[model samples]
Target: QAIYNIRNNPPQEDGACKLCNHQTIQRADETEEAITNRLEIYNQKTAPLIGYYEKEGLLKNFLSLIASDTIAEIKKSLKV
Candidate 1:
């Protein structure tokens, strides 16, 4: 999955989302450098965080292949 965010947008005028009919904007940070920087930041921070959880036997890794599945897993883990 790509790492990026679309801010302040909902597509409309025949460009609505297929499922919700809501406008969706394309991510702006699609450049190779931008994406690489993001991944580097994530790798730098996430490893330590995950290490902490793993040491405590509380680590829960979720696959990001399908967004809905990952979100569902997160929600379930949070119990909310």
Candidate 2:
């Protein structure tokens, strides 16, 4: 769906999708080690918070889904 949106929408004046193009350059230049380091840092930061939430019975787990269905599933899970 995101790909479809990108294909159908007109590009900005710079010939890029402002929302999507921002990450392309940085991601393209990132090395595997950099990606792994980032993930390790992220996990270290979030693991304790996730554990706290779980202890408080505030953590909700959901299966991962395709991008197109994620919003719908989240809304449904939230009963919104």
> Pick by lDDT: which candidate is best?
1
Error of 2 at 80 (Å): 1.9
Deviating ranges (above 4 Å) for candidate 1: 1-28, 61-80
- Give lDDT tens digits, candidate 1, residues 1-80: 22223354434457667567666555557756889999999999976898898999898878889899899999999898
Between which residue pairs do clashes occur in model 1? Answer: 10-23, 11-23, 11-24
Local error of candidate 1 at residue 62 (angstroms): 6.1
Worst lDDT run of 10 residues, candidate 1, spans 1-10
Give all candidates' CA lDDT scores.
0.72, 0.65
lDDT of 2 by residue, 1-80 (tens): 12213346544656554667642222332556887888898899977899899999988776665865777787887899
Candidate 2 wrongly placed segments (more than 4 Å): 1-29, 64-73
Displacement of residue 38 (Cα, Å) in model 1 is 0.2
Any idea how many clashes model 2 has? 0
Please give the RMSD to the true structure for each candidate, in Å: 10.2, 9.8
